[model samples]
Target: MSEHDKPGRIAPYPRPAGGWDAIKFSAASLRQEKVVLGNLKAFLKQNQPHGFDCPGCAWPERRHTNRLEFCENGVKAVAAEITSKLVTANFFARHTVTELMRQSDLELEQHGRLAVPLRYDPTSDTYRPIEWDQAFALIAEQLHALDSPNQASFYASGRTSNEAAYLFQLFARLYGTNNFPDCSNMCHEATSRGLPGTVGIGKGTVTLEDFELADAILIFGQNPGTNHPRMLGELRDAARRGATIVSINPLRERGLERFSSPQHAAEVLAGGSTELCSLFIRPSLGGDFALIKAMAKRVVELDDAACATGGERVLDVAFIETHTVGIDEFLADLRQESWSLLIEESGVPREEIERLTQLFVRARSVIATWGMGITQHRRSVPTIQLLSNLMMLRGQIGRPGAGLCPVRGHSNVQGNRTVGIEERPTAAFLDRLAAVYGFEPPREHGLDVVATIQAMLAGSVKVFFGLGGNFVMAAPDTPRTFEAMRRCALTVQVATKLNRSHLVHGQQALLLPTLGRSEIDLQEGIEQSVTVEDSMSMVHLSRGFKPPASDQLLSEVAIIARLAEAVVGNRLVDWRALATDNSLIRNHIAQVFEAFTDYNRRVAAPGGFHLGVASRDRVWKTASGKAQFVVHPLDLDTPIHRARRQYGDQAMVLMTTRSHDQYNTTIYALDDRYRGVYGQRDVVFANRRDIDRLGCRPGDRVDLSTIWDDGIERRLNGLLLVEYDIPLGCLAAYFPEANPLVPLDSVGDESNTPTAKSIPVRMLPHLD
Candidate 1:
C-alpha cells in the first residue's frame, strides 16, 4: 500500500522517470475514467495531425509525431478531461456553495464537468441552472452599469485557442477596455518583457529540431519529471546520442537523472533506463543571477587568455562586433562583479563555474532554456537579460542548434499572447488592428494580474471576466485575492469544470460551461477545429473526436462571440458570423498579427507552419538595430537580506511549487508521487539541517509567516515539515495552498510578475 493508505507516514520515493510506476499510474487513471478500447485508440491520436492536442503542456510536437504521441502526464490529463462523471444542478441543490467551498480544490473540480450554465443565488446558497441567453444578458447588464470601461478586467487562460483568444481580445477592445490580465502575466511575464529588448522578440528563437543538433544544452530552474514529462524523451535521446545536458536547480530532479522510455521494448523488458544530465548544479534560491554572471566572467577571462597567448578566442568577436553593441560596457559590469561575492551568493564553487565556462567554450552549438524557477523572482527581468547577454557573447542567437528557449508551461499561452492578449500592445499592432476592424483600440496600457487585484481591492474594478482559469487560487496572497475578488460587482467564469474560483464569487457570479479539448465543438451545423501554438511557435490544428458531455455545453468561441453580440452587437464587425465559423476569426488574426500571414492556407499543412521568428535569422529588432549586450549590475538586496532585516534572523526564502498530480491550480490528486508525498497537501519540504535548526522534526506540524513591510500579517497554518534535498535558508511548499503567504505587493522588478518562488518567511510551531 502507498503512504496515502496510512495516516501520517510520509514515504520517500526513489527511482527516476518513466518506470513501471508510471505505467501503473496511467492504468489507474484509465480505470478511473472508465475508458474502453475506443478511448485507448482516441488517446493514441493526441498531438497528431488529425486529432486533438494534449491539454497538459506546451512542449512542441515533433514534425512527424510518434504513434503513441503522449507522455504519462498527457495520458492523465486526457483521462481526467474525458472522465465518465457528472455533477448535476440537483447535486448543487443538495450542497450549498458555503459547504462546497470547505472542500479541497481537487475535490471541487473532481465534481466533474459542468453540464449547463449556473448562477449563484446567495439567498439559496446554491447554484441554480440558468439559460445561456439569461447569463449573457446578466453579464451585459452588469458590464454596461460600470461607470467606465476601465472598471472591468478581462482575463484569458492559456488553454484558450488562438481563434477564441483573438475574438475575445477583439470583443474586449471593441467594448472599450485594454484591461487584459492574462495567465502569462503571472508566470513568464519576465521573458515576454526582457527578451524583446535584446532579441527583438519575446518568444524563443530556437525550434524543436534544433535540440537534435545541440552540442550542449543548459536547463535552468525547470523540472521535466513532474511538470513536463514529455521533455524527458528528448533529453533521454540527446543523452543517448552523446550530447551534454546540464541542469541548474535547487533540488535534484529525477527527470534529469535517468529516464526509462515506455516506447523502448528492450529497456522496458530489462527494467533499464537511459541516464541524462551530465552535470547537476544546486544554487541558492534567487542565486541564478550571480551564478550566471560568474560563468560570463570566466568566459571573458578565458577569451583574453587565448588572445594574449596566441590561440582562437572563445567568443565570436565577428558576431559581437557586427551583430551586437555595448560589449565593452557589459564586460566592465562583469569585471566589477567580484568572484568572492558571486561564490558567496551563488553557493557554487569556483571550480564548478570554471567547468561550466569550459563546456560553453568547447561547445560548437548551445541552447540555453529556462522556466518559472528563474522567472518567478524579484530580479527576474534582469536575470533574463543577463541570460540574453550570455547568449550574445557566444553568437548563439542566430546559429543552428543554439539560442534562448523560454519553455512555455501552458498549451496555447504563447499563442494567446501572439494573437493579442497583451496588456502593453504596440502602436503598430493596434494601428493594424484598427485598420482591419474599423475601431480605435485602447491606447492606454492595461492592468496586469497583480494590478488587477489591487484595482479590485481599491473598488476601482467592478467586473471580473475570465475566459478559462481559477484566478483567485492561481494568484498570490490568496486571502487578499479572495477578498479583493469579493469586492467585484460581477464575476464571470467561462470554464469546463467547477473550481475554488467559482466559490470565491462576487455579489453576482455566473458559471458559463464550455466544451473541453477532448469533446467535439459544433458551432452551427458543422464541427469546428481549433488551432493552438506550442512552445516553439508551431501552430497546428486540433480536432476533437469524442462527443460532447452535455447538449447544453458551448464552445469557447461561441461563448465569447455570444457575449460580444449581447454586449456590443455587430457595430465593429459581424460577431454572430464569427461565432459560426472560426476561419473568419483566423483571417482577422492574420490581418492583425503579421507573422500569421496566410493563416488559413498554411495552417492546413501536415505539421502546420512556423510563424518564422525574425530573430531566428539573426534579425535583431532592437532600438540599436542589432543584438544588444545589456548590462545587469550584481550588487543588490536579495530576498534573504530583506527578510532578515524585516522579520528576524530566522526568516527563510520560501518557494511555491506544484505537485506531481497538478496542473496550475487544478489538482488531479492529493498526492505528489515523485516526492513520495501522498494523501496530503499541507506539507513543506526543507533541508534536514534547517528543520533541525528550526527545532522541528520530520512530520512535525508548523505554521509559516511571511516577512514584508506590507504592514499585514500573511500566514499559513497546519503545514507538516518533510526533510528533503534542498539548499539551506529555503523552504518549499505547493502553490495555491501557499499563495496566501506571498504578499500582493511583492512583485518582480519591472516585470510585474509575482515573486512566488522567492518570498521570505519564518516557520513557527503549530499551536493547533
Candidate 2:
C-alpha cells in the first residue's frame, strides 16, 4: 500500500539544521541503499576537481579545499544512484503493473536499479525483457507510423548529461519536431523567459565567488537547508563574515534561520549553530510580486526623501542613466501604486518591507537569489523583472558581488537548456545547428510541458519519449497527466530505475534501462567522461569510476545515439562515432554554441571553465541595448485571488514543497527531519489562526479540493493538518502528493510554468 495511507507523527524539532541528525540520516540513507563504507571512496570525489559533480542541486562547486565535498542530500542522491540492489527481470515478473501501481513512489525506487530493457505486455499486465536492438526497432516503427513529427513529444529531464541532451535534441529536430518539453519548463521557465528581455541573459549572472564577496544576500522563496544543502556552507560563511542575510519566504525555514555544518566537528561537538539570516520576512503565497513592488516603492520613496534633505543620493542616478531603459514608466507605476493595496496583496506589514528595502540600500553590494517559489506564480515573470529593477536601482549588476541567482533544482537543468534542449529554439540557434550539421532544423516553435499534455488529451500527440525523469509524478494534475500518458499510442522511457511513468503506459510502451550518473561509462574499450553545467553556468567534466549497475545498461548518450541511428540513420552525421567519443559531441556543441568554444580543452582545465554571461559585463542583449525595467500591472486576478473573490473566506493558497529526504520526484525516505515530521509524506502546514478560523483543528485529517474555473474536481484526500509558522490564508504540502491540487491550465503568465506554488484550495472533510 502507498505510504500516504499510513499514519505519521508531527512534533516540533528542537535543534537547528545540520547537526548530528544530518550525519545520522545520511549514514542511514547509505545503509538503506546498501552502499558499503568501502564504496564511499566514490562519494568523496563528489564536486571535487577531476571528479563527478553531485547529481542533486545545481549549486556550483568552489575550489576543492576540504576532504568531504558533498552535503547530506548529496550523499542521499549518491547512495540512491550507486546502490547495490538491482531490479532484475525476476523482480518485474513477481509484481504485475496493476500490483506495482499500488506501491508508493519510494517503494518503487527502493526496489533498485533496472537491469535490462523491458517492453510492456498488456495481456499479462507485466513487462517482459526485450533486446536492445528490438526495442529501438519498436520505437522507430512507432515514429514512422506517426502521422506527423509533431505527433511525437520528446521530453528531457535535468539528469541528462550535456552530450546526451545535445544528441536527444538533435535527434528530435532531425526527425523534424521541436516538441521538447523539458523539466526546466516546470521550474525555472520563468527565469528563462523573464530575464532575457530585462537583463539580456536567461541564466543567473552570479558566481560562487560572488557569494563570498557579497555585502548582503537576499534569499527569496527558497529553502537552502533541504533543496541546496551545500549552499548552507556558503550562507554560513556569509553570515560569519558580517554580510547581511535576508530570507524572504512564507514558512520560517530552519535552514534559513540557523545551520550547523555537519562537516565542522567544532560546531557539531559544541551543539551550537550559526545564525544564517539577519532578517526573515514571511510573505503570503504568490505575494512576492507585490512584496517586491513594495520594496521598490520604498526604495524610490527613500531616494526622494534623501534628495529633498540634500543627503547622499539613494538611487544610482548616473548608473541608471547609463545602463537602463524604461525607468520613467517603471517609476511612474511605482509612484502610483497604493501602499494599502501592496500591503494587502503581499500580506506583509509596511515596516518589514521598509526594513528589507533599507538592507538593500545599506549594502555596498548585494546578491538576490530565488527558487521555484518565485517562479511558480501567475506574476512570476514580472516579479522577477521587478526584482531586477530593485537591483538595477543600486547598480547591482555588472559588479563582482552583486547579481541575480536562480537556484535550479536539478544538477544539469541549466546545462540541458544550454545544449539546445529547448522547445522554442531561437532562429540563430537553429541556423547555427543547420550550419554545423548538414540539415535544415525546424523553424517553428513547439509544445512545452503543458501544451504537450493538452495535445495528448486531444489525441494529436501519439508518441511520448522521455530521456529521464518520472513525468507522471513531476507534472501537475497527477491523475489527468497519467490519463494523458495512457492516451499516447506509444511511450518510451530511457531511465535508470522503475517509476510511476513506466507503469502508466500507452498502448505500447518500452522501458530502456540506462546507466546511472555514478556508473562508469565505457565506449569502444575506453572510459568516457560526460560534462554538466552547474547552476552558475560553469561547464565541468563528470567522470564515474564504478562499474555499471548491470551489463545490459547503456550510457544516456549511447541510448540516444543508437535510437537516433535506428530512426534517422547515418545519412547526415555519424551517430556511431558521436556515441563512442563524447569529445566529438563536445566539438559539435562548440560549433553550434559560441559559448562552448574549445569545449574539450577548456573543460579539461582545473575546475572547468565558465560559459560567460553577457549581463555580468553590462552588455545588455535587449533591443534598446540597455537593461529594461518593464512594468506589470498589479494582477489581483491570479488564480488564488480570483478564488478568494468567488469563495470569500473559504479560499486558501497552497504551495507544493520538497521534503529533506527527497529530491524532485525521487523519494528516499518519509521523515522530514527539519520539519519534525516522522515517517510521513501526507501532511499540510497552516497557520494556527487559519486552522481556528476555518473551524478546523490541529491533527485533523482533511481533503484539499482545488478551486478552478475549469470545473475539474481535482482533490487530494487524507492530509493531516499541522499548525505551523506560515502566513494567514496560505497552506503548504509536499510536492507530487500535493501536485494533484494544481490544475494543468493554472500556469504562470508568459512563462507557462504550472503554478505549483500558488494553488487555490478549499479544505474539505476527509472522505474514506
Candidate 3:
C-alpha cells in the first residue's frame, strides 16, 4: 500500500520546521482550493500596510520591510477564502441535512464557499434557498415573539471585524439584553479575568518591538509553529542574538526546539535550523500553578543567600517598594509550600526548577508568554496570578523588554471583546454606551458560552444567533451541546462557508452567507474598509481588492444593520446609513470609548495605531493604585487527581490539541506533520511508561471514557495508541474529537472556560 493509504502510520518528521516543505505544502493548498493563479496577488496584499489582515492568526505584523509578510498558514487561509469552488442552491438540493452530518469536517469544508442564504425545511429535511429580506423578516418575527430579550442569545466569533462587532453589540443592547456569548470565552478568558486584579489590565503588556530587545523569553504551554507560525521569525532573530530561551510544556514541541524561517532565503536554501530554547522543562497537565510557585520559592531563597553574603541584591527592592503591594503575604505563602509537594505537583525535579530560577536571575530582561495550555485548567486564574507574582519580584512590568504576553488564537478575538462583545459589561462601559446611543442599555449580566448552553437545554433561551463560527464543533460536551442547539426555537448563522453548526439545526434555522476577509466589501456603490486589532493591541485598516465570492453574499456590517432595522425599525440610530458607511460606526465607537479618539483619522495612517495599555505605562487602575501580588496555595487536590488516586492506573489526564493542518474548528487535512501521524486524527499520544502501565502496546486500539461524577456517559472508541514524548500519566489528542470527553461543567474557577487540557479519562483496550 502507498503511504497515503495508511491509516495510522508513525514516522518522525526528518527535517526541521519551515523549509522547502513549507512552500510545497502551501502550493498544494492553493491547488486544492483551485486558486493557484488567482491567489498570487493576495499573497502580496496580505498583512501589508494598506492590505487586508490575515484571517488565520493574531500575531502582529512588523513595518513594511519584506514583500511577503504572510506565513504558510496565512497562505492556506487566503487560498481557501478565494477558492473557485462554490456551494450553490443546486448543491444543497443534492443532499439532506441528515446525509451531510455523516461527512467528516474535512470533507464538508472541501465542498467550498456558500453562495446564498438558506433556510431549513423540516418537512423536506433539506435546506432551500431563501431571499435575504424574507430571512431577516422571519428572524425578526421569531425574536419579537419571544417573551423577553433574555430568551435570545447572540454569539460572536473571533474573526469578526471591529465594525461588525460594535454594531452587533449595539443592536443586542438596544433590544434590551446583554446575552452575548463570544469565542474568547473558550481560550483566553483566564487571562482576561486574572490580569486585571494584579496588573490592572486584561491584555498583554508587551509590544512587537519588545521581542527584539529581550535578554530571555520563557514560553509556557504554547506551540507557535502550528498555531502562530509567524512567531518563529521573531524567536529565530532572538536566538541569533544570543538570548536565552526556555520552554515549559508537557510535550517537547518541535516549534520550540528549532525552527528555520521560511522568509529567509539563506536559511531555507542551506537547510539550517536555529536553536530556539536552552532549556525544555516538561510539566504534567494542570501543573503550571505549582511549577510557577516552585520557581518563585527558589528566587526568594537565592535573594536571602545573596543578602547574607553582602553581595548585590538579587531582587529589585526599590522598584517593588514603589510599584507593588502584598509582597509580605506572597512570600509567606511561598515559604509555606513544601519542596516535596512542589516537586510532586509540578512533576519536575527540584534541580530542574532551580536551574530555571537561576536563568531568570541572570537575565536582565525577560518576557513570559503563555497560551491556552496554561489557561484551560480549573486553577488557571490562580496560575496566571502566580506567574505575575514571580515577575513582580524582579520588577519586570513597564520595562523595555519584560512583561506578560498571552498569545491569542484567532485574528480578531481580542478586537471583538474590545468592541463590547461581552456578556458581563462593566458599569462604566454601559454608562458610556447609554449616553452615546440615547437609550438605556442592559445593566444585568447575561449568559456566557457555558451559561448559554445550560439555559438552552433548560428551554429558557429560545433563539440563537451566530456571527461566523461552527458553534456545535467548537463547544465542549459535543453530545449535550448538540442537543441544546436542537432545543432552540430559532437558530441563525452568518458565515462564508458551510459547517457542522448548520447541519445540527433548531426548530427553524437560517443560514446567511457573508463576505470573507479577502473579498471586496462594497456599500452603496463605494468600497469600504474594516479594521482589526492584533494580539499586541495594534489596530490597523484591512481593505480587500479581490472580487467577492458571490454577489448574493453581504458584508457582516451590512447584514447586521439590515437585521437590526427589521427588528427595531431604527428609533434613535440610523441603521441603513450606518450600513453604507463604516466611518459612521467608528464615529459612534469613538464617542463611547476614550481610547478610540479620532478613530477614523488615526486608523487611516500607515500601519495603524496602538491602543495604549495602562499597565505598560506604570499606571495601575486597580483599587490600590499599585500592582498587587496575589497569593495562591500550592495544592493539587483537584477532580482529575482525585479520580486518578481512586481509579489507580485507569485514569489519565487528556489534553485536547490542534493539528498542524487545522485552524480553530476548521479541519484542512488529517495529517499532523509535527507529531508524525498521517491519514488519521484518532491516534492518542502517550508516554512509553504509561503505555506499558495501561497494558497497551504500540498501535493498540482502545475505548476511552470520561471519569466524571455526573451520570452522563461520554465515551470515544477505537483510538490507536502511539508511544511518544509526553509526561507520565498524560495523554494527548486532537480537539473536537476529544471535546466529548470534557464535561460542560468542568471549567476554570473565575473564567468559566472549559478545562480541555485537564480531562480525567479511563482506557479500555479493544478486544480484537
Estimate the TM-score for candidate 3. Answer: 0.99
| Residue 719 displacement (Å), model 2 | 1.1
Question: Where is the poorest 10-residue window by lDDT in model 3?
Answer: 1-10
Candidate 3 per-residue lDDT over residues 1-768, each given as its tens digit: 446337667788777888787887788789889984755899888999889999899999995546588888888888888889999999989999999999999999998899999999998889999999999999999999999999999999998999999999999999989999988889999999999989998999999999999999999999998999999889999999998999899988887887888888888889888999989999999888888999999988889889999988888898789999999998888888898999999999999999999999899999999999999999999999889889989988889999999999999999999989999999999999878878989899999999999999999999999999999899999999999999999999998888999999799999999999889988878889999999989999999979888999999999999999999888888999999999999999899999999999999998899989999898888989999999888655799888988898778899999988889998887888878888899988899998888777988998888999989999898999988899998999899899999999999999999999999998878765
Mark the regions of model 1 whose C-alpha exceeds 4 Å error after superposition: 1-7, 646-649
lDDT of 2 by residue, 23-97 (tens): 988888888999966678987788888778888889988854466888899999999888899999998898899
Please report, as a residue range, the 10-residue window in candidate 1 with the lowest summed lDDT. 1-10
TM-score of each: 0.98, 0.98, 0.99
Candidate 3: which pairs clash?
none
Please give the TM-score that candidate 2 achieves against the real structure.
0.98
Worst 10 residues of 2 by lDDT: 1-10
Error of 1 at 46 (Å): 0.9
Cα RMSD to the true fold for all candidates? 1.4, 1.9, 1.1
**Candidates sorted on TM-score, descending:** 3, 2, 1
The lDDT for every candidate, in the order shown, is 0.88, 0.91, 0.91
